[model samples]
Target: MSEGLKRDYQLCEEIGRGRFGTVFRCFSPESGEFFACKSIDKRLLLDSIDRECLDKEAKIMQLVSGNPNVIQIIDVYEDDSYLHMVMDLCDSSDLYDRVSKRIFSETEAAAVMSPLMEAIEHCHRHGVAHRDIKPDNILFDGRNRLKLSDFGSADCFSDGRSMRGIVGTPYYVAPEVISGRDYNEKVDVWSAGVILYIMLAGIPPFYGESAADIFEAVLRANLRFPTRIFHSVSPAAKDLLRRMLCKDVSRRFSVEQVLRHPWITSGAEGRRDQ
Candidate 1:
């Protein structure tokens, strides 16, 4: 325990766990503030190749944390066995938990999505791709501001250079990625579309009991909006979903285009007027 950390902060219980690290709820006695410290195992990243990936994730988070939709990484500490990142802690739970309780209206979903799309747009603008955009990584702060976390699968890429290697959760992977074709950050938009689908429907757009079945369904690229479940959804909402979920990446609406989308703009205007 003596070598577990530096002296500034005291570690609390574990808040979450991921393949790379365990996140802890920590408190700084001097600042009297709570922060999340993700302790990434240095042993797992001993390989030069794996080390580069984790290093890149930290840089990307540092580069884009200033954005409103993304969580802040306040500081970093490293020891022989671990690399610890001190980050903003969101206590309101994840977006998945919120939606699990009830289906969100188009307006409600739009409000939550507006800032997220901004964050994604900001990341793309900065040449970063957050391959994982599942609901579990999206959290809400005390003020209800949605913050995007978990950039472990994130990458930084050159413009127009195809980012090879399919990375992302199976159910949310873009079709182009599944086809083993060269892909870019547009893949994140597709994942966001999947999130929107789950937010409104309380279920995934594509699903199967087995991993193979899920992959086949994703590869099939058929989106089902059963009237029974979607009858109450609006045309504008469905239109955005259609374009965002378009199988063809070329035909998919870019993040900027999505921001201008009526579904998003209308909700923004509503929120402003209220």
Candidate 2:
């Protein structure tokens, strides 16, 4: 890698794009590791606050990127035109594509979520809140190792206080977030629950035709596990989802609780039994 925006990596193809940036498939000849280069146009960062958050995002990655399940910023470059970050390229695609297209078995979902919960716990311990924890952000590598990527909407809480402001995809927004109340990292639990629901049922627990409607549904939080969908799902899995998707923050499960949950542990025990 070079000192500035110029580097030895060759950006091969456009892999992903979002409002904040575009991701390109990149290759490094020296390391022989495929990476995804996320480039954010400077014009999109209209103010200093936006730029600060972008820099903070990079800092958060620097703090928690050591985890195997975390797709961290490998290297960064900035100039007048854009800010670019070379990140781990998870070749197996995202959870949205996996479970959204085809429902993974309840046991399979539990196994996948095991590493994810640990990764979230690791981030929380580092005081970084990955506010956005959706299926799209959950990725896997060529070997099917899970990773949680995309830190654009992530936040850091050093002083230990609830963050105020509605930020995150409406589909996965927590009820407190929709109600415009101060909320903590538990918002991520709701998002992870929603992803789990989608993984088990092949659909979002809350549904609507528009963004407003989706927000309303989230605020209501009427999570119904239809028999047609959840008939084959284990009772323990449903219980975990209910605890996670609970509207009351006090009642909702934390990342630690999720790791200790029976459903998750059962999968581990079963694997050992085998």
- The candidate 2 region of ten consecutive residues with least summed lDDT is 265-274
Model 1 CA deviation exceeding 4 Å by range: 1-5, 268-274
Q: Give the top-scoring candidate (lDDT).
A: 2
TM-score of each: 0.91, 0.91
Tens-digit lDDT track of model 2 for 1-274:
2355355688898988877788899989888988888898878988998889888888888888999999878888987778889988887867878775687777788878899898899899888889888888889988899988877678877687778888899888898988988899988889999988888788899989999999989988998999887777777888899999999899999999998998898873432211
Q: Each candidate: how many clashes? A: 0, 0
lDDT at 260 for candidate 1? 92
Candidate 1, after superposition: displacement of residue 208 in Å?
A: 2.0
What does candidate 2 score on TM?
0.91
Tally clashes: model 2: 0
lDDT of each: 0.84, 0.84
> Mind giving the per-residue lDDT tens digits that candidate 1 earns over 24-121?
99998889999888889888775897888888888889998888789999888887778899998898878878878888877788988888899999
